[model samples]
Target: MDRTVVSVLFCFVSYVFQLASTEKNVYNFNGGWETDESKMLARPGICNIDVVDVSKQTFSQKHFEDYYAYVKPVIIKGSTDNTKFRKLCEKTALLERYGDKIVRLSSANTHSYSKRDVELKKYVNEIMKPQTLDTLGNETYYWFGDNDYVEFADLFDQYKAPPYKLPNMHGVYSFGLAAAGTGVPFHFHGPGFGEVIFGRKRWFLYPPEKQPSFNPNKTTLHWLMEEYDNLHQLDKPLECTINEGEIIYFPDRWWHGTLNIDTSVFISTFLG
Candidate 1:
C-alpha cells in the first residue's frame, strides 16, 4: 500500500476510537447515580404517624418518636375555621392586579377560557402553558396570581398550631389557586417539608412502597407516575374534598397531585 493511503487510514481509525471514548464517558457520567439501585429502595419507617383529625389529636413529640421513622405521610383534617380562611382568600390584591399571567408546568394540558367553567378559567388557561423542566430551581412564580403567596402565609399564620412557627419570609407559606376543569402538574415537595392542601379539590397520593422499584436519586413524581401508569389500577387515593376552613397534611416525601373540581383557592404550609 502507498504510504499516504496508510497514513489516512490510521487517522480515520484514531478519530473513530476517540468518538467512542467520548460517548462512553457521557453515558457513565449520567448513569453513575442511576445504577446504584439500592438508594431507591423505600425506607418504610421514616414517617411520623399521627391522627389526621385535628379534633382528635395534634402532632406531638410522642407521635413523632413512635411513627416518624415508619410512616411516610399523614393527612390531618379540621385544623382551622372557615371564616378566617375565606378572609385570607379574599386578600389577593396582587393576583388580581397581575391579571392572567403565571409560571406553568411543562407539557401540561392547555385550558380554554370559554369552556363554561367561570371567570377564573381565563387565569388558569394563561398559566398552564408548556415549559421545560429545569431541576427544582429556586426561581419562584405564581401558580394562581401574584398575591397568592401572601394570602397563603396569612392563612397559615392564623391556622397552624403552636410550635408550628410561620416563617417571616415570603414563599414559606404559599397559596395555589386551581380553576375548574384543570389540575396542577404532578410534582413532589422540596426537602424539609410536606404540603397541606386547603380547599375543595380531589387529591391523589402515591406511596413509594407501592412503586415497582425505587430510584432515590430521582424525584418522587417520576416514580409515582411510573407505578401509577404501569399498575393500571390506582390504589384508592386518600381523597378529600376539603371545605372552606379545612386543611389536610401530607408528610414529606409523599407523592401527591391534585385536580380542581371547582374554582378553588388553597394555602400550603411547609413545616420543617
Candidate 2:
C-alpha cells in the first residue's frame, strides 16, 4: 500500500472509533444528561383529581394534584382510547430490529421462599410459558436496557414527554404477556411518584401506612412473598381489576401488588 493511503486509512479508523465512543456515552447516560429547572421548583397543594385530557395538556402541578387525589390508584375511564394505544403497543419494528442488543434478567439466584413464593414463581412461569425457568429468568423485564435510546427512540419521538419523560422521570415502562395464576410481589417505589398500569389482571393497592413494617428500600424478593401471607390479617386492601382502555394511577410511596387471574398483556408507566 502507498504510504499516504496507509496514513489516511489510520486517521479514518481513529475518527470512526471516536464517533462510536461518543454515541455509547450519549445512550448510556441519558437519564443523567438532562435536568430541568421546572422539576426543582416547588408547588404547594395536596394532590387532587381534575378531569382533563392527558393527551391534550402537559402534566403540570395542578394535574399532579388532581391525579394525586381522585385518580391516584383509581381507574380513569376513557383516559386513553384503547384502539390507538393498542396499535403503538403492538408495533414490533423496534423490538425486531434491536432484540439482540436488549438484556435479560438473570434467573439463577433463588431467594428465600415464603407462603406466597409459589404464587410469585408460578406467575412468572405462566408468562414465559413453554419456556423453562432458566430461559424466563434470563429474559429482560425492562424495555429500556442500557441502550434504551435505541430501543424506544421512535416511540419517544412520536409521543414525547407528556406521558413518558426520559432521564429525569426514569422513563421506566414494561410490557409482558399475561400469565394465569401469577401476581407481582408487594412492593413500593422509593422516590415514587405514580404508576399507570394497563392490563387485564386484578391489581390490589395498599396504603403505605397499612404495611407499617414494609421497607421500600430494603424489601427483598422474598419479603414481598411474606407480605402476601399477612394480607388476611389486615382490613380488605383496596382491590381493582385493571382492563384495557383503563389507566390506574397509584401515587408514590404506596405499597401495592397485583394478581393476574387471567392471561393478559400489561404496560406500566412510572411518572415523577
Candidate 3:
C-alpha cells in the first residue's frame, strides 16, 4: 500500500475513535449510553381479551397442543418452578448480593430502541417505583433485561425453569425486573415463554398473521391509557393478566407486549 494512503487511513480511524470518545463523555453518566429522549416511538390500536388460563392440576400436553396447533397464547397457572429464585428475588435479597453491579435498562417505549446503564442498587432503591396517577411512561421507566448472563448465572443457578419449550428449539434464559406500569413495547421474535416470579403482569398479544396497526413512538403505558379500552370490539388483542407463579407462552413471530401490574421480577425462556 502507498505510504500516503496508509497515513490517511490511519488518521481517519483515529478521528472516528476521537469523535466517539467525545460523544460518550458529553452524553452519558454512570456507565450510560443513550436515553429514550432522542428516540422514536409507536402508536397502537387496542387491547382486548382472548387468552386461556389452565390450572396446574389440569395442565396437560393439550396446553402444549393448543400452543403449537393454533399458535395461541396460554397462561398456565402455578406453572413456574422457580423455587429458589422466588426466595432470592426480593428487593433486599437482590440488593445484598448484586447491588454494586451495573445493569442495562431498555426504555419502556414503543420502538424506542435506547438503553442506559446504572447500578442495580440504585434501580431497586431509588429508580423503580409503582406508578402514580400523576406519572405515566413519559417519566422514563427503564426495563432491565439480559443483565450480564455470566455475571448473574449464580443467581439463577438453582431456579427450576419452565419444563416445556417449543420442540427442537434450544431455550435461552433471560431474567429481568421492572417497576409497576413499565414494560417492553410491541415486538416479535422467535417463540418464547415468560414467567413472573413475584408480581402481576398484563400481556397484550397479536398473532403473526395479523400485524397490529400501531404508532412506532408510543409507549405501552400511553397505549393502555389512551387506546386500550377504546379499541374496537372487533379488533381487540389476545390479552391476559398473569400473576406470580403463572407462565405465558407466545409463539414465534407473534407481536406481544407486557406491563407490570406490580414491581415485577420475571424471567423468559426464548426458543431458538
Candidate 4:
C-alpha cells in the first residue's frame, strides 16, 4: 500500500475511536407496562407501615441506646445542616468539579450489587434520567448509589453528621445522586441514618427478622408492578417519603428499599 493511503486509514481509525470514547449513553426509558390495577396502586401505596416523624426531638444517649439502636426506626425532620453539601451536589457543580472523576453505579436488577464505572459529568448528561414503567430499575435506569466517599471527602466534610453517637461506633460517610422514579430491591446492612439533601425519597422498610417476601433477582419496580396492588393489607411495608432535610434512621439489619420521587441528592452515615 502507498504511504499516503496508509496514513489516511490511520487517521480515520483514530477519529472513530475518539468519537466512540466521548459519546455517552442516553437514558431513553421504555414505558407501557402499566396495568389499570398497577396504576391504581401507584407503587403499592397500600400495606404500608407509617413512618413516624421525630424531627423535632433531640435524642439523648439513653433514647438512642434503648430504642433507635435495636428495636425501631424513626424519621427525624430537619436533622442535618447540609446547605453547603447540597450546593455542591447541584448539577452544574458536580459536572464541573468532578467531570473527569469516575463514579460507580449499581445495577438495580438483582440483590447482589453489580457495578459499572462512569465519569461524573457523563452520568449527569447521559445515564441519570427519569424513570418509566417498563424499564424501571432495569440496567438502563441509572441509580447512582455507592458514592466514592474518599473522593468527595471535602463535600462530605461540609455536611453535618447526626450528633447522637452510639457506644463503640463510628460513622462512615456515603453520598449518592439519582433521578426521579427508580429504586433497588429490599436489602439490609448495619444501622445508619440517611438524609435527603434535596428532592424526595420514598422508603419501604421491614424489621430485621421479618424477611418479607421478595425475589432477589428482581428490581423494586418489578415487585411494585406485579405484587404491590395484590398484597394483603397486613403485608404492606412501613413507608414514608423523606423530603429535603428529612432523615430516616434505619435500625441495624432492618430491610429497606428506596424510590426516588424527585431528582434527589442524599447522604448516609453508616455505623460500624
Candidate 5:
C-alpha cells in the first residue's frame, strides 16, 4: 500500500478514537460515565425523575421524608451487593433447600392468568426451560407476593437492606422470581423498597399526578398487562433499570411496572 494511503488510514482511526473519547466524557464524573440526565431532567413541558448515589455511605432521613411524603420516585445506587443473595437464590439452591415448599405463582397474562399453589421445585423447573411463544402463550411465570415469610426465611435473611430507617411504617418483605421476557404490568400500590439480587429489570414509573392520563378502561388487572406505548405522547415517564445489587425506593401510589431484561430474582417490601 502507498505510504500516503497508510498514513491517511492511521489518521482516520485516531480521529475516530478521539471522537469516541470526547463523547464519553461529556458528563462523566470521577472517571465514570454519568447516567442519562436528559430523560430525568425537567425542561419546557417535560417532567423527569432524579437519580442519586448513596454508595459512599450517605443516607439522609430528610431526603427520604421529602420523596416519600411527596410521592416522588428516585433511583438509588450502590447501597448493597447481591453476591450472597444470588448464590442462595440460584435455581439449584432453591430446589435443594425450598423445593418442597408450597408457594403461589401468578401468571402474567391478564386474560387467562390466575394464581396457583405450586411446589417451589416445579416453579424453578419451569423457569429453567427455554421461553417460547407456547411457554408464554397462555401465561408466563411471574412470581410475586409470597406472603409467608417463614417459608423464605433463609433467602430473605441473605439480602442486606439499606441502613436508613423508614419512619413509623409497617410492611412485609417478599421474594420475586421471573425469567427473561417476563414482567409485571403497570400498577400502583404502597411505598416500597426493591433490591435486585440477580439479573436486571427495566422500570417505568409514572407519578400519581399523571394517574388520570392512564386509560381508565385498561387500569384493571385484566387489561394492565397490555403495554400502552401512547403514554410517551402524554408524558415522559421516569425510567431506570435496577440491576443486580442496586436498590430502588419509590413512594406509595406511584404507577410503576417492570420488565425483566434477564432472568432475575428480586426482594421487595411495601410500606403503607
Candidate 6:
C-alpha cells in the first residue's frame, strides 16, 4: 500500500469517528419529543420551603440538621448542566447506549401500583410522544426502577454523596424519565434527596401537620393518582419548582407529590 493512501485512509476514519461521537451527544428538541404545555399543572400559589443557592451561600451541617436533615424541605440550587448524569441522559445517549436493555415500567391506579417489562427504547419513545391532560399521570406516567442501574453509573458517580448521609441508609436509587404533566399523587415517605437533571419539576409538599388531609382512603399509589385533586381542598402547601441542576431535600414523614412540567429526567436517593 502507498504511504499516501494509508495516511488518507487514517484521516477519513478519524473524521467519521468524530462525527459519530458528536451525533451521540446531540439533543435535538425540535425533531424529537415535544412537551404539551397546556397539560402541565399550575404551581400552587403558595410558598413555604426555603430556596437557597448552595454554590454562593454556605450550607452548614447545623442548617441541615435544624431544618432539612429530618424536619423540613429545602431546595438547593446547584449546577447540574455539565454533570455526567445529565450527559448520559441525553436522548441520543440513552437510545444509542441502553435502548435495548429491558427494564420495568411502573404505572399506578387507584387500587395499587403495577409493573410491566419493556425495552428502554420503547418506553422512551412512548413518553417522548405528545401527552394529554387526562392521561398524564393516570394512564401515561411511567417510572424506571432498578436496584442496579450499572448502565448509568458513569453519570451517577459524578455527583458524589455528601459526607453526612444518614447512617445505614442504603437502598436502590431510582431514575425517573417522564413527559410534561406526568406526576404522582400526594404521599409521605422517608427522608430523601431528589434532583432535576434535565427539565422542570413542581413539588407539592405538606408538612407532617397537614398529612392527615392528603392521606387518602385507599392508601396506594394508584389511588393517589386517581384522587390527587382532593389535596387541593387543603390549605396552602409548601411548593417549589425544581429546574435543571437544582435539588430538593425532603425530610422524613413529610407528605409530598411531584409533577413534571416538561420532558424531564430526575435522580433520587432515599435514606432508610
lDDT of 3: 0.69
Q: Please, what is the whole-model Cα lDDT of each candidate in the order they appear?
A: 0.42, 0.42, 0.69, 0.70, 0.62, 0.65
lDDT of 1 by residue, 31-121 (tens): 1112122322221111223336667776664664355423544445565444544444442532453334333322222222112222333
lDDT: which is higher, 3 or 5? 3
lDDT tens readout by residue for model 2, 30-69: 2221112232111111223333446565655465555553
Give the alpha carbon lDDT tens digit for every residue of 148-170 in model 3. Answer: 97778888686777667555678
Among the numbered candidates, top TM-score falls to 4
Query: How many Å off is the CA of 212 in candidate 6?
Result: 5.7
User: Candidates 2 and 6: which is better by lDDT?
Assistant: 6
lDDT of 4: 0.70
Candidate 5: TM-score?
Answer: 0.69
Candidate 5: residue 156 Cα off by (Å)? 1.6
Which residue runs of candidate 1 sit more than 4 Å off their true CA positions? 1-51, 56-61, 68-70, 91-171, 191-199, 209-239
TM-score of 4: 0.76
lDDT score, residue 184, model 4? 69
lDDT of 1 at 37: 20
Which segments of candidate 4 are over 4 A away from where they belong?
1-58, 136-145
Best model per lDDT: 4
**Weakest 10 consecutive residues, lDDT, candidate 2?**
39-48
In the range 1-272, model 5's lDDT, one tens digit per residue, is 99999999999999999999986563232112113333221111222556667766555778677655456776677766657777777667767888899888776543445777888777767543323333442355557775467877877787677655457877578788765555665677788887777666667677777763443223222222344443455665676777667777777788876656556677887775
Which residues of candidate 2, in runs, are more than 4 Å off? 1-72, 82-85, 91-103, 106-127, 130-147, 155-171, 190-199, 212-234
Candidate 6 residue-wise lDDT, 1-272, digit = tens: 99999999999999999998776444325124444456545432344679878678877767777767877788877523446656677778867877887767665332255666777798877644434444423455376455246766665666544433665677347777776656666767688888877767788787787753433322222333445556555565677888777788888888777767677787787778
